[model samples]
Target chain A: MSERIVVDPITRIEGHLRIEAQMKGNRIEQAYSSGTMVRGIETILKGRDPRDAWAYAQRICGVCTLVHGIASIRAVEDALNYDIPKNAQLIRNLMIGAQYIHDHVMHFYHLHALDWVDVVSALKADPQATAELAQSLSSWPNSSPGYFADTRRRLADFVESGQLGIFANGYWGHPEYKLPPEANLMAVAHYLEALAWQREVVKLHTIFGGKNPHPNFLVGGVASPIDLNSDSAINARRLSQVQDVISRMRQFVDQVYLPDTLAIASFYKEWFKRGEGLGNFLCYGDLPATNMRDRDSFLFPPGVILDRDLSRVHEIDMHDKAQIQEYVAHSWYNYSTGKETGLHPYDGETQLDYTGPEPPFKQLQVEDPYSWIKSPRWRDKAMEVGPLSRVLLLYASGHEPTRELARFALAKLDLPIIALFSTLGRTAARTLESKLLADAMQGWFDDLVSNIKRGDTRTFNEALWDPSTWPETCQGAGFMEAPRGALGHWVVIRNGKIANYQAVVPSTWNAGPRDASGQSGAYEAALQDQHTLVDSSQPLEILRTIHSFDPCIACAVHLADEAGDELIKIQISG
Target chain B: MNALKSIPVLVEAPATRDFCYQNTLPLLHEISHALRRLQQEQLPTTIDLNAIPFGPGDEQRLLEFLGRGEVSAHLEALGNSSVWESGYPGIWFIEHRNESGERVAFQMEITTLPAILATHPDDIAESLSSLQKALENPSLGHRIGD
Candidate 1:
């Protein structure tokens, strides 16, 4: 008998998603992954000032708002060819780095932890052992015996209070909670520590953005103007705070994250070999200089992997718009054959035929097919992006720090020195990346400070060429390393105003639909090998594990009421 | 072939937290009128762009400010902070609480003609001068908030 298992409204991860897996016996025979919702972000952007898109783009996804903000700005700058300032480049880099650290921490603890480590299992943990684990790590007082004792008390309080609002729907003490009582105790302690630190560190963004989730970085220069006097004083505090938070986080990664992942991963050593997606990885390089790229967009050097054969990723010029096309033959968007990125919106040529096929990634079934995301391939090949890609690129380029971090992390996790290119290697890869980036932030920070001391703190460039400054009226593509993965924004301009703004989001690449061939999107392919589903009610654990791929679907929600929907006139019917 | 005595350009606001149709609804007619008046003067329109395309942030500190996050996603929605919208990078600050006790998050919009429309070099110089003057000085007659 065929059983239809619908994991509707997949929670915890960003955006609205539903997974339909046809079960044959105990295994999932086929899968249908549907994002199911659509927001008219592209349609709304039509006929607006191009500069505003930078401000507009951040709303795409909370998980990677910085990516959206940068993508939008890069698109406009790519069209204008406006040179960004060096100080601004460092600031952007730091901000993006913080975002990566923040996102990964959240992805691990708040989202993915509950899947492996049971929340209720903490009750059975020996508080003394937990305290011992904490105190043994650098003799830190924050995780002392007293702290664990109190943490145990708080857990009791939470259960008694019935105000376990955050943990309301949690599947605590589930049978699959794999770990020793002592390890669970340690994990519970660090979970709280990570939460507090995550909240504390986001302030860096607030000081600059006036808020955090989606910060505002001015395109040409820094947004918060340096009132030389105010900056010297305020920056001292801000910079110190950033360093302190980063160091604290580093300790947690070294002491807690590494230990927790290993302790837990050891219990489920089976997963160490499963869920590797596509085998083809892609990463657009980061750390763009102030000048950006001239023609080939040396900003994010593309990194592509076809099967096992890896190639240096290159930018597809927006001028040659024909090269970058998205085929929705199997997507929710039913186009008239193949539609280019410049025109792939719902209204443009969308055909909503749910009758297309199962897991649309399988729709083409050749090389780059499967998934709802429009399979975004550069030069007709599937590519992988994000931490692994970054690590690989850094290693290939002989970045010693990244290589060292990778080696150290592998040693701790008891992972083989296989150069970190496996399905189960994502966790180690992300951890090592966090270390590399945390260290690099200091390097970049010192560089910026030295440059500042040398009297080179210019922040913006006003492009007013010798009368022949209409920017040649051509198209340009801007690719940047979003905290999540490969994020690219393509723009085609005609006579100054934005003619087309195409954003192939990180989620679009990672959680994309199938390409022309029958290859699974990154996330879809990753889910195929999963033989475990503890409880159907909590697909969240699995979703969290899958979403660790860091898929940010920005245009998943759209509220298109009558044009005059009095938004703030709260008719709070008491 | 142009007998346009009085023409007004309808400039739509970017899909930002502030300047959304929801927040600016009460004064839509006024904004439309102000936009018409600015077009007659021929200046680049001052507008609010949508800083975020998704929901508001789960935590307020995530609402970093550049030029965006100046508006609140809460005020733009129907309920008390919908997760779908709030999960996006959104913010809404209360300048003054409204009548229903639901505070209004607004954008200070100053619509002028496009700055690039100055026909001559002197005209361009004059246009920039006037634009800066307008930015520094908000016309009392076109005032947004009370």
Candidate 2:
């Protein structure tokens, strides 16, 4: 009954990853997550001015580059104790929100759908019925016969162009594609529509950062303030365009994304059962001004576990570093003594050797150094971080908008809101949050306009807070929400430059290394119980589910490409 | 009726580059030599350095790390204000005055921190002491010095 299902070279994702699932009968018994290749990004930053870390770090992952840019800037800021202005904060929030909407929409339609909905089956869809479905939804835009026809023509043109970046080597006519021909046609048209919309929305980040695909944002504040004529920073028309784009996103998320998720996810109810990894969730508080200082002011409240029918909860003081420790038992490299220690980020070690199992207590003293990423623990537990954690946190904190949005979505789908604990639930929450965030951004924009009109137009502080003047040794960790999930950058600065810079990225929590106890990371645990419904060798479903976690491996990158390098992603749990 | 003029297709110049992220010196050398060969062969791809941030006053941090001294070329001062986190990545950025009325900028970077540490007096002294007994000349660094 035991079988090893390998999903190597996970396609449609940004980077290379392979999932080796040890399945016992239909359920996964043990999951070995392997990522080969060391990009030497830290080496890439070794001598560069620490300020340029953002510009370069963002390039680590294309999809989540914006988050990395912000995270790197935040880390440096933490070292310098630089505080951003209110206008800068608003601009950042809007830009980051734009990325979230864009990412969520792209993930839903482009990446995740291919796993479930068959594309070639779409060719069989009836144009008339597809048109009818479009017309049925009043709020939906461009859902007409002519629109679908144009979509067909455009897809053909692109195919003729031979620029199939997304659709390359696709499993086009999978028998599992469950939609009728007309419905497929409708979805296909929307898919094309989504791509065009995606391009426009990504521009929102460019308006603030100066370029898309990793826009440059200043650490203390933005590079420059928003002014209409100065040709220095982003122009006025661009700002308005950004605001308009945000509005359009709200419309799309509400009328399109949310509805589409429900429609597609409803068909895959079986996924609701399996692929639900470590029910224990951790969401670091986000939106600093909205919930400043008060740790409880999480847009999503702290931590929740759904064992007793989604009833019980607990508070996690993530400050307890002892709870985090990584294991190299199944890893390739050998540690000197196999002793795991709580080393700061700047002093991170990457000793590469495959000496097999490590001895206890000698973890830190291991003669061989392994991995660029250090295992982070939260009360000695592996925590899940992502849309699920964010939404769950929001639900726990009882944010009115998030609460109502969740309720409305569940009601619309006739789903129990508690079902949000499932994968489908997490997906819905993201789409719902997307719609809600779109509306919230409008209000935030208004507040920004008010600030600008009141002669509070200054955005950046070119001043650097002197860390040398302070006590020679003090450590601080920044906990905020990246678009994907919670992101924290811990910095220790001495003299003038940085002495230590460590980060526990959101994906690290979701796709971390095994703990000192050899327990799996969040995604590994999530993949434990799943039926090998199709080809065990190429389980795209597992890839979809795991990638849905969107692990950020760059945070864990070291000189070597061992599990130790990626161990950073797994915020080890108790 | 739609009428359109017939156009003849001609294949000519297309925009592309032989630029690559050469991670090793061998790769860079190989590409350079290949470009030489290609220039002789009149190949299509144009290989040239697009932009290098290394120049005087650029403070190429990489070079600083490698213990290289600072060199100021033609860099516009930030108006005598040193209160910001701005520096040209610790490497010198230089732009020579071209009489043709054009602009040229390039950066020199060589891991500023490591370079500095490698050439530091204390570190050099330690290395010399470690090799003191290996030679009778009594000059640990004299092998490469005056």
Candidate 3:
């Protein structure tokens, strides 16, 4: 008999998620990934000014605010054939780069690290031994015995006070924890340091966007004013501040974040064998481009890798109705044409149909409409998208930095290239890309400053700013590589207003429910592949694989109430 | 306490704005002090923006006065939460809510990073055995710790 183990609202990720896995003994036979919320942001964008779409669309998720805004503007620009100034592209690149670094660092230390590090064990750690271990790993300057002692003291206080603060409600002292006391202590110290580090790094976003979350964005260009002398504008002082922030980011990635990832990941070398899903990777290339149409100059090439083959990269066409379509057969949505047919974003519909077992049920009615997220398929395939996909895409494209970094990481761990397909590999990929972007961002910053110095201070292009200048009806696809994975926004305009807008965010591709053909998504497929539970009640194995993808369900199904609350009322009755 | 009482609250002359907070002097002083500590020590601090029992529009007024800083993050790991640094270096605003989007925890964290952003050890302990068992399986078809 197969026992179904459900882990609802999987902790330490963005938004509410429920994972139901069927276990025949210790091995998982099948899994279901469900986003327990409805995303109606696309419906909200209907009949609104296409120019102002970024502001509302940016609210899809608080975690990835700028990516949507960028994608939204790019969609409008693609439709109207508007080209922004070169400086604007450079600034946008810098902002996106900062997001990747900031987000990846936070994910590694704060979100994913706890899956591996044993905090309760750290209580037994000797501060001096931890300092010695830190010194042996890397040249990070914060490895003093005093520093470790301070961190340990703080932990002791939290433990003794019976108030763990953020550390509360965790499954402590489980039989799964493997790291020794010293290693745990070292990771705990860095976890504290990363918090301080991230606070300073986000200043770059505020400097450019005026605010960090949901920053003001204009359709043509950024909303920031360029004035070299003004205290309020993008002046000399602010430029230097950006440079300082970049320096700080570089130091932390090299000194703390990268070293900590490698050190902790070294303990769980077995993870490199599991969590490999779909083996089909897709990347919508971004960065290192002056013009949006110039695909040849992309740093991360846009292509699809099928069956883990690197020989031929398949071309991507976001406009093809038959190429990329969303299936609703297994989701809590109804398609106008039928549940079996896939609808392209241009013809996408947002009809809510709840067919799952009502809340508090023992199990989801997995046979039909199990999730609120629509199944997004690329060429009718369930493709995995995220850092792992992007890194593989880069490695397949023969990008030098990615090739060197991937090879070096594999060699460092004494593992072969095939290991990159597993859970630890997925995580290592994020850290590798973070290092790559950390170096690439400086080049973009340099280009921006030099352009400003050369008197090309223009950022926005006003040629097609007005809706009257647009064609009577136009539709276009705006695609970019968000920190999570491939993000695309499709927009249709009629008489200068948005006829329809559909955003296929990263999480939808990774965490969506089953498709029309009963094919599992990246999350479901990966979880069921080789996952086993020592104790089914403690389904930490499921979280390990799912959190590796960094599931952000809020981005998948976007919406909240008047008080900006996302409240789901669950009824429990037999 | 008396020193806090000495600070004068700044009230804008009545105008047509939609919302106004009567007395924000205490909050502003705390923010200012937090900012000073951040600059001086390179520390991160957080303030609970959603938990206060402020009058009708005081939260909005306080946030606006803090102004937007360079970086903001939406953390969805545990719940729906948002963290942003004030224009002043170290002061941060953190707000967390439960699944239904009801505010559960809010604080003004005056540190280099907010406490909510770090992963706790207990979360890892739950999985160690599963990870170890997965490795112990000979059918996994991969070498471990070679």
Candidate 4:
């Protein structure tokens, strides 16, 4: 008999995500992924001034906070055919690069490490042994026995006090936990270090955009101005600070994040074999060396890799209506045409409809409409989008650094190329790309400083600042490779106001439910592939695979009706 | 200085009505519950203020309602942290700032003593051992001046 298991309000992620697995004994036969929250940011964006869209769209997800603002601004700029200065482009690159490094490191330590590292077990570890383990990993400065001893003491006190605080409800002693006590202690120590490190690095965003979560964004260019002699503008002091933040970021990624990921992966080598869901991958490349219009200058090139084929890279045209479409067959929504038909985001509609089983209920009616997220398919195929996809795309594109890093990590782990398609590979890919972006940030900063030195410090173009300059009707797809994966904002502006706006975020591509023809989304397919439960009641295996994608459900689902009264209250019970 | 003065300052009028108090009443209720738990079970609870979304003036109003108590402290570690007791005996307000002097966390901890104010046992032991060594060798005390 196939027994069903439900893990609802999945912890350690940005928003509410419920996973249901139909199991035959220990193996998972089928998995259903549902995003239970409705966020109607698109509905809120309708009829608003096109330029102000970024400010509103920035509120979509507090985790991947800056991506939507970038995408939204790009959409408006794309619609207006506005060209910003080279300085603006470089500053934007620095900010985006910082987001990628900051977000990826935090995810590795705070969000996903607990799945592999047992916190409670760290108390039993010998600090001397842990210091030895840490020294072997890398030349991180805080590797002395005394340092590990202090961390262990602090962790012991927190554990003994009967208050786990943020570390509570963890599957600490699960049989599935494979790390040694020393490794666990080392990881726990770095977890605390990462918390402090992240707080410092995010100052990069604050320096440029004025704040961290939902930083200020401008449609024409960045809101920051450059005047070297000035204290308030992008002066010498601020630029030097940006340089310092960048160096700090690169140091952490080089010394701490990279070595820690490899160490953790070495213990869980079996994970590199499983969770290889839907060999397909998609990337909307970002970090342009020149400008957005100059696609060839993109550091991370845009393309689609089908069937994990590194041979031939497929092209993606966001403007092509048939290329990218969202299917709502199993979603809690209805297209004006019908539920079965897929609509391109330019023509995307957000209609509030709840057809799933009401809250405080046992099982979701799996066969019917079950999720709030729309199944975004590229040419009607479920493609995984995230760090693994971006890394694979870069390697396939013959990007030398990405290729070298992947080879180095694979050689270190003694894993084959096929391992890049699995759970652990997805995580290692994030670490590799963080190094790539951190290095690339220095180059961008240098370019910006050189431009300022040459007295070409223009950050904004005032030509299209006035709405009267825009054509009566225009539409554009603003896309970027977010920290999570591919993110695109489709906008249609008529008469200087937003006629329609739809954002197909990264999580929607990976975490949406099965489609009309019964194609499993990335999350569902990965869960069903090579996954076996040690104990059905404690589904640590499920969390490992799901968290590998770094699911941000808040980015996936939108809000409810205008009054918000149409939202269904979901009550989760153990 | 002229460049700094040239920078535009964005200011908005406060909302006519205080929605934060109305919307964040549940937080007040949670504080009450934490107080009760402290009284009944002798248990302490910490509410991360950052976790709660406060509207304009909502945090200030809540702080004003909590008022001030006699006890307050300043601590420096990875950053600077301020802890103070509210008008209510058990409720304490704590704000932690990083090296950049940016507020990292603002929390309302309900306890007899905020955790940051208490010296860790390990630190206490280390302090005792250091003091003993300094007494044995007066020269060791000069190292602090160095």
TM-score of chain B of each: 0.20, 0.18, 0.58, 0.81
Compared with the true structure, what per-residue lDDT tens digits does model 2 show for residues A1-574? 6766666556655555556676776566777565443565544454345566677667766787687777777666654556778888778778777888898888777766677666556655556677777666546967777777766666667777887776776766554456666666667776767887887788777777767887887767888566644434544445567677876788888788777777777666666666676777766666554423455533445564444123556655444544433344434434444545433333343445444235332122122332333444566666777787777767766678888887877776677765776666666667877886787677677767666656577788767633344544434455666656777655454444444445567765665556566667776777774645465544655765775665556543333222233222223222
Q: Residue A95 in candidate 3 has what lDDT?
A: 88
Report how far residue A454 has shifted in candidate 3, in Å: 0.9
| Docking verdict class for candidate 1 | incorrect
Tens-place lDDT per residue, model 4, A279-359, is: 999999988999898889999889999998999899998877789999889998877778899877766776878988766
TM-score order, best first, reads: 4, 3, 2, 1
The fnat scores of all predictions, in order, read 0.00, 0.00, 0.00, 0.00
Clash number for each model: 61, 79, 28, 6
Question: What value of lDDT does candidate 4 attain over all alpha carbons?
Answer: 0.88
After superposition, which runs of candidate 1 have C-alpha atoms over 4 Å from their true positions? Answer: A136-140, A231-252, A289-291, A294-301, A309-324, A337-372, A396-398, A417-423, A464-469, A530-541, A555-574, B1-146
With candidate 1 superimposed using the best TM-score fit, by how many Å does residue A13's alpha carbon deviate from the native?
A: 0.9
Runs in model 2 lying further than 4 Å from the true structure: A43-48, A153-169, A173-175, A228-235, A290-313, A316-319, A323-348, A354-375, A465-474, A555-574, B1-146
Candidate 3 lDDT over residue span A140-225, tens digit each? 88899998988899899889999878788666777777789999999998888788788788888898897887667788887776
Can you give the lDDT of residue A439 in candidate 2? 77
lDDT value, residue A126 of candidate 3? 94
Better of 1 and 3 by lDDT: 3
TM-score of chain B of 2: 0.18
Highest TM-score model number:
4
All candidates: DockQ: 0.01, 0.01, 0.02, 0.03
lDDT of 2: 0.59
Q: Which residue ranges in model 3 land beyond 4 Å of their true spot?
A: A558-574, B1-146
What is model 4's C-alpha RMSD?
Answer: 11.6
Better of 2 and 3 by lDDT: 3
**What is the DockQ score of candidate 4, to 2 decimals?**
0.03
